[model samples]
Target: MAAAAAAPVWSVDPRTGKRREQVAVEATAAEVDTAVRAAHAARPALADRAVRAALLRRAADLLDAAGERVIEAADAETALGPGRLTGELARTTYQLRSFADSVDEGAFLDVRIDHADPALAPPRPDLRRYKIPLGTVAVYAASNFPLAFSVPGGDTASALAAGCPVVIKAHPDHPATSELCAALLRRAAADVGLPDGVIGLVHGFQAGLDLVRHPQVRAAGFTGSVRGGRALHDAAAARPHPIPFHGELGSLNPVVVTESAAAERAEAIGAGLAGAMTLGTGQFCVKPGLVLAPEGEAGDRLLTALTAAVSDTEAGVLLDHRMRDAFLDGVRTRAALPGVQAPVTPGAGGEHTVSAGFLTLAAAALAEDGTHDLLLEECFGPVTVLARYTDEAEVAAVLARLPGNLTATLQLGADESAGRDGAGRGARLLADATALAGRVVVNGWPTGVAVAPAQHHGGPYPATTSTATSVGTTAAERWLRPVAYQDTPPALLPPELREDNPLGLPRRVDGRAEHA
Candidate 1:
């Protein structure tokens, strides 16, 4: 990125409340244009499958070599401990290598072919279909996960794997860490004989808007708040040549505890819930924000256990002062509601530290939409709300009121309708759970997201823009579109879509599927 140097951007340490490093100056519109154009010019060079895979692998290697320095910068800016940051770096590199392996597999292309069928009513012609990469892509870094969701995050990794050059808009909270990771990726590209501009980086808020509006960009991927993500999504849509925007905005991640499960293992559920809620100072996007449990002896037991565990957790620092203020403001607004109980008040304890907390309220309070509506919004800190339900109907009603979430978990008993279906109350609960969430967890938490083939980190509406995932192997599909050829000469067709199937890819032909 061309540094304007007009104004300096400082990286502040959240723990000590002081500036750590001057990363880079903000990028102007002209600089943004230059960076994006450079990325667009390098698309063909990055399109080779072997080269892309090697580039990603090299990036993983470079990150591993610079792990100590990167972790130190991330810790200084975000105040996430060295241990957690190390694990996050591991996950980030693992994600890059996983995408590299997917590129090597070649199945992500989703190629198909069909010979001409004269016996049909309309006399069909030969057709071949395969997914192709959109041109240049814009990636918006997330603030919560500095390494995994920032410069070398999943969005950037998957886009590169899909043959799309990326122009990253670094999040302001960790600009230093973003710069470090960006340098590593560029070095990896250079090592793999790829262009330096294969991955472009820009800093500043308006530069992000300029990136999505740039005509050369064909798609975008974002991970952030609902307000910010929605604005960018709308901007991408409003463009003359509108692009596909895949954004994981926000989620409440509501969880329901069955009476049987609570009775069987109330202490276990409570302990797990406390740990997940306070993980990363409750800054994780998938942290559980809402809990619905029956108001009974079992529920009381779980609450007692959860409260004890939460109270024992020491306060931790937020990512920045603005986030700390927003978290406290959210807590205060919710606590001011009538009949709301704060087991551990989540308020700003010091100049930069915040305490973990949980709120309690009757489930019926959400049935009517008023100030109680705040309960549905995501509070991005170490806090959660427990809604006590009088009966299963109340739980169902509460679930209906919730927005789409990344995950919804159910803690069930060992034999609670595990096999029986006719009168097994589990079916109804499962049905309700699947309606509101993408991944329904059974007797587990949603804090740790696994990066695998079947994993989907998205849901309806507010959770994400579309059903597509921002993680896992299928994520590359978001940066790709399908094109079908009809009766084209084999020599003129791309090798992957040729009649001879030179690439050895599995393709559907003559109404029959082939997988190899």
Candidate 2:
């Protein structure tokens, strides 16, 4: 018999369990440094707002025109369906436009000028300050949102918008798609006369490490596991001249269904959670991995509804083999815990798919034992562990025990949800929930991240490193730092900081702040 052609290098597709393509991994430290230098050299021209906005608009146009091609490429490489890919592409384009709009708004410049006035008692000096680009950014693409968080994702877009060149370390899971998107971005940059080297990508773990450690890299942006994010964060911190590392590490996003809310509409909440937990196979950083529903008949009812809803949905394939194996392993680990029951045991729905389901554990077991704490950690798959609380006190205690998260949700009824009951207790509960997360959802699932200026898509601790800014429009702030210039001549001052303000941007002039 003739020899079979080496089984066409295995690559899993999330939508359909099949091989898509064989990705080539070839790059060395020298090549990476060359790319970074090219990007660094090309930074100044691309830093202009008009130039960057035009590049972003060109990218959005390309995404719109060739969206289908991009979607197909992503779906083939990731096993994600067309429907999901389509939505992700839209989000990616929307994000590009959002950044472009932010550039036009000029608010991201954040200009503040304390003009010289020796006449005052304190004799204030000409302290003119504004944000400046951090040279080059090293972005680590995510496996789950290949397009939206990948080569052409928010990190690259935001970095470019902030006038910093980007060097992306593509995720190995979907390298082909990453390459394709990189090509499109390069073409877009070329079209607008922006340097093609403004954006570069590399594949492989070693390459990622090298990129992070590259001396010229001014700052970093990451969206991945806590382990990976922390490693990069530590590396950046340990560097000779340490740079800021803005990472959205990981989160066991928790949802609390107050006793009254569960009693009012258990079924609706259960069904909604099923969708959230399994959306993209529970790969989102904002997925409600931990749910706190008060115990008693109401909690049981919510559990039952959740079980039925999750059981009905077919198990979807995770991002890659590593994630799939981890999900299965996590589920098994949690199930082995005492007082934990998988009312709906997740199973392999298809060749590469795993079913969606929930596991129930008593609040006491989680509180009393350290083993159960593992159940609270993120499994990164279509599995949620519903911790049943016997009463409000137990719920509060468990809430207190939770690590900081990207989002904390509370499902409340008309009376309780209003936060203005006759007894004035509702307001207290609302305030308490808001304090626990970066984004607090009153009655909705936390999975859907809306692209808006007001959104704060970050949280405390392991959820994110520094809590001063968010990962939305505010994410640009991370790549730029404020520098104050004092007692400088008009000729020496930056055009934006001069008394006449040629750019017509908002600034604090004289003693009063004004916007033009």
Candidate 3:
């Protein structure tokens, strides 16, 4: 019997809906297994913190050296423009260096020690605890930001920082970019005296499934749609030895415009909303999809400003044809709903691009669950739904019905901002936002996500499969597990756990923080 040939993976241009080139063949199950095993084999090479840190820095340097070529390749497949791709590449390299710094600092290990107390009524033995890497990780690349969220993204960087080898499942939208970045990462590993298998790449739908179920793959990180992330999360759970699945699924990043806020800066708020919702063609996961604006003259003024801004903006190409079709269908369906009005209709611009716009409906309609509930769901394009509310009760009702989000924003007025209203209306709204999202914004939009230690890029339920973030310095925590050694001999202790601090790692000794 002859083995079936693997299907070819092509790099397609979303701008013209044409195949740019054949990047590689879809990996078969055997090939996926090979990649995972290879990654697993390279685990020991990343055990040294210095080596891991060096590898990350080298990877960032290599990516920077190839910035022009990398950006060109990503732009060709994603249609995201050279400027956006350049920024994405810069963010990607910055994330790599940040994780490298995290590796060198070694705070992520979380070392703790409790000395033996022989005089106590119930004697206690010496116990030392610290985190260790969870072997190889399977990273599912995203389709939007081909550089920052795809090949050399935060997930891969964080996993490597945690001392885990990575096998990235390339997004179908940008296979060439993935291949190029993977090669650079492998070269960096080799330059640091680590095995090339420290970084792995595979392309295929089934290959993604195979990678998650592989016994050697201890954990996985994902960034994609709700349906796809949920399916993979289920697959990881169904495994006999289930692994941790950190998936950034979806969010209807909601924004609320207080009456006073609209009165104070209706034009500014509307213009900002237009820019935020249409940025990157509204492909950002944190794009404000739903907004609650007060009804009356001020809200009307805001709407007028929004309409002008969106109308003046040009139509843009999406990442792929499927997303374009989905966006158009979503707009059409939402527009057809009763009581919904498209202040400026959003739909296909040319055969390849889509225009940006917004839809309006009464907040009362969304207060109770029904057909209008569809309005609360995320539409991944340059469109946002504006729901007009008559009072605070209507605002609460509409907000209560929203699903979990990565970010929730509140536009407050001067009095609210200063907490001088005496009624604490702003406090209540801020509290409500905190309950519904991981990151809450005040008088700002949720379009751009910063890569910093304090950033929280995940939220409840459908927003993410786990509480762990897919961005920032703490993201590496997802790939580690704590281990405790009880009454172990000094000679047997790891350098980080020794009585005499050797590695100069930050640790907690006898319930007190000790800096080496």
Candidate 4:
């Protein structure tokens, strides 16, 4: 018997709904195994912090050097526009360099030590603890962020920073861009005296399944739809030795507008909402999908402004035809629901593009959860759902029905902002927002996510699978596991845990902080 021919992977242009080119063939099961094993074999090279840091910096330089070519390819396949793709590339390179700096800092190791205490009840023995790389990580690239969340993205950079080599399951939407970025990363590894196996890329849906199931792949990171992410999560858990599956799934990212806030600047709020919801064709994971607004003259003014802004906005192409169809279907379903009125109809535009729009409904309908529950789900295009509420209790009722989200935003009035007459109400709302989301916004939109140390990009179920973040310095922590050494011979101990503290890493000794 002979092997079957490998399937071809084509790069399609979203704008024209045509295949741009055939980038590569789908990786077979054997190929996926080879990629995983190769990455696993190269893990030792990343164990050295200095070499790992150099590799990251070199990768960033190479990416920046090829910025024009990279952006061109990304824009062609994704139809995201040159301007947006350029910024995404910049963010990707910045992330690589930032992870290199984090590697040098070495705080992610999280070393801790405690000397023997003879006076203690149980006579505690000497112990030293620190984190070690889990092993080779499998990264599932995302469709929306071809660069920042795809190849050479945060997951890959952070895994390498934690001394784990990576094998990326390239996103079907951007295979060519993935191949280009993977080549640069491999070149970087070789330049820094590491093996080309330090980075690996594979294409196809089945390849993703094979990569996750490979024994050598110790952990996995993913970004995609709830259905897709949940399926992968289940696969990882079903493995004989279940691996940690950290997935950024779906999010509704609801927004709440107090009556006073709407009264203060309904027009401004409406215009801002229009911009945020339609940004990136409302493809952002943090895009505000549902908003709770009050029912009154002020709210009507807000709706009027939003209607004008969205009507004036032009239609745009999504990442793919499937997403365009899904967006249209979602809009149609929600629009046809009882009491749901389309202020501006959102559906297919010019056969290839989709126009932006919003749906209006009574908050009371969403309070107890009936057929209107569909509105709470995320619709991945330029559309939003506005629920008109009669009172704060109605607002609370609607909010309580919402699922876990990446962010929860509150539009506050002047009195609320200053903690004046409505201080108690503001405090209560803030607390509620905090309880519902990982990141809470006050008087602002949830469209942009900053790559900062203090940023928390993960939240409760559906938003992410684990408590860990997929961004920031702490993201590296996901690929590491802590190990404690107990009363080992002095000479046999690793330098980081040795009594002499040869590495000079920041650690806690005898319950006291020791700075390098």
Name the runs in model 1 displaced over 4 angstroms: 1-5
Which digits, one per residue and each the tens of the lDDT, describe model 3 over residues 200-253? 999999999999999999999999999999999999999999999999999999
In model 2, where do residues sit more than 4 Å from their true spots? 1-19, 420-425, 468-470
C-alpha lDDT of candidate 3 relative to the true structure: 0.94
| Residue-level error in angstroms, candidate 2, position 284 | 1.6
Candidate order by lDDT, decreasing, is 3, 4, 1, 2
> What tens-digit string does per-residue lDDT give for candidate 4 at 312-417?
8899989999999899889999999999999899988778899999999999999976789899999999999999999889878887887888999999888887
Q: After aligning candidate 1 to the native by TM-score, how far in Å is the CA of 511 from where it should be?
A: 3.8
Least accurate stretch of 10 residues (summed lDDT) in model 4? Answer: 416-425
Candidate 2 lDDT, tens digit per residue, 167-200?
Answer: 9998877878888788889999999998878998
Each model's C-alpha lDDT?
0.92, 0.82, 0.94, 0.92
Better of 2 and 3 by lDDT: 3
Put down candidate 1 lDDT per residue, 9-82, tens digits, no spaces.
88999987888878898888998999999999999898789999999999999999999999999999999999
Clashing pairs in 2: 13-79, 14-78, 14-79, 15-79, 15-80, 295-389, 315-354, 315-355
Off by over 4 Å in 4: none
TM-score for each prediction?
Answer: 0.97, 0.95, 0.99, 0.99
| lDDT, candidate 3, at 131 | 97
If both were scored by TM-score, which would come out higher, candidate 1 or candidate 2?
1
